[model samples]
Target: MRHIIAVLLENEAGALSRVAGLFSARGYNIESLTVAPTDDPTLSRMTLVTTGNDEIVEQIKKQLNKLIDTVKLLDLSEGPHIEREMMMVKVRAEREDREELKRLTDIFRAKIIDVTDTSYVIELTGASRKLDAFIDTLPGGAIIEVVRSGPTGIARGEKGLVL
Candidate 1:
């Protein structure tokens, strides 16, 4: 099963490396990871996505909690939550393809952030599936490059992570 584990940890040197090393040492795969300092400058929030059986996930959580820097850990996938990823696609948008690209962008509610005579950079943010679908709608061979910020999530209720 895939799990979105959100972790609050001390913001200090080598903290990220330690967390990643733990997973590497165990041979577990992290599909996506996004980390940044939270409002309380002393801490950082990490949203990590990984796939494993229930037992493996449980182990991962336990090991994470044992880390010196880890302040708290929550598996957002366990309850109501929201996830979003940002993707930017640069595609060939020549004279003939410009109209079609604009139409497709509108359909996906994406923004054409940059425009050149022959190409465009479109930015989209949504669930992973929505991003994938937008890519599928683009013309074949039109894609020049794609950059995605892996999924990040938070719980849906009034509750949240705090110091």
Candidate 2:
């Protein structure tokens, strides 16, 4: 029931607020949202994750398209696409734990981006489940802090989503 909806809209002040307000006013939920200016500086691209059955999702899409700022909209979840999220985890890496953590990082193909005598920051990028699996491999109390850039996605093949 989860959906990833990609939208291109005018990159102006209050644009994001309007989109978020629409969801709130309608009592809908956005699990994750990532927005940034696109190649065309006059526009911005937003990727939002939400959940609902087909009917609810269709209704949400129609409402989004009604917005004046919206240039184009696509439900990437409807077709072939790829999704990824990036996660950085700082863990207790001291003494014996250092070797174990290193081994686990290698197994996950994650990079040890930052390191100190007693801690390490490991960066991993992949599907949300892959990140969860990596976190599960760490020993209890080993985690210091975690940061994630929620999933972003795009459709596969030749065509691009555009107006």
Candidate 3:
């Protein structure tokens, strides 16, 4: 099964490397990873998506909790949460095609962050499924480059996931 694990850790040098090394040493593949500072600058949060069996998932979580810098770990698969990812896509556009592209971008609720004679850079944020759908709708030969910030999520409601 696929699992999404959210880890809160101290904002210290090598912290991300350590978390990544753990997965590498165990031969576990991280499908997606997004890390950023939390409201409190002293800490950072990472959302990691991976696939594994029940036992393997449990073991990985256990080991992750053992990391000295880990402040919290939440298995979002078991909780109610709001998950989102952001993508910035640059696409080639001709003057005639620009209107159509803008229409599609508006439909996806994506913003044109930059525009030039030949290309437009669009910023989009939403659930992974929504982002994928938006990407699929682009015109053939339109995409010039893409940058994605992998999924970042937070549990919904007053209840917090950290323990």
Candidate 4:
């Protein structure tokens, strides 16, 4: 089964490398990863998506907690949370196709953040599946490049993950 793990760690140099190395050393693959500094500059939050069974997930969590730099680990897949991903897509578009592209973008709640004579750069944030569907709706051979900030999740209610 696929699992999403959120880790809060000290924002120290080499901390990310250590976490990544731990997974690689164990032959576990990370499907998606996003990290950023939290309100506290001394700490960073990371959300990682991986595929593993219950036992493996628990083992991974236990091992992560053992890392000195790790502050907390939460299994978001089993919790009440709000998950989102951001993506930017550059697609080739002509004047004639611009209107249609704009319409589709509106339907997906995406915005045209940049535009050139031959391309339109769109910014969107939503669930992973929603972004995938938006990308699929574009014309064939129109996409130039795409960038994604892997999914990030947080517990929905007042009860946050315990340290």
Over 3-97, each residue of candidate 3 has an lDDT whose tens digit, in order, gives 88999999999999999999999988789988888888999989999899999999989999999999999998877888899999999989888
Q: Provide the global lDDT of candidate 3 against the true structure.
A: 0.91
- TM-score per candidate: 0.97, 0.95, 0.94, 0.96
What candidate 3 gets wrong by more than 4 Å, as runs, is none
lDDT of 2: 0.93
**Candidate 4 local Cα displacement, residue 70, angstroms:** 0.7
Model 4: CA > 4 A from native: none
Q: How close is candidate 4 to the true structure, as a TM-score?
A: 0.96
Candidate 2 clashing pairs?
A: none
lDDT of each: 0.95, 0.93, 0.91, 0.91
User: 21, model 4: CA deviation in Å?
Assistant: 0.2
Top lDDT: which candidate number?
1
Error of 2 at 141 (Å): 1.0
The collision pairs in model 3 are none
Model 4 RMSD in angstroms? 1.2
Per-residue lDDT of model 1, residues 21-80, tens digit only: 999999987999999999899999999999999999999999999999999999999999
Task: Output candidate 2 Cα RMSD.
Answer: 1.1
Best by TM-score: 1
TM-score comparison, 3 vs 4, better candidate: 4
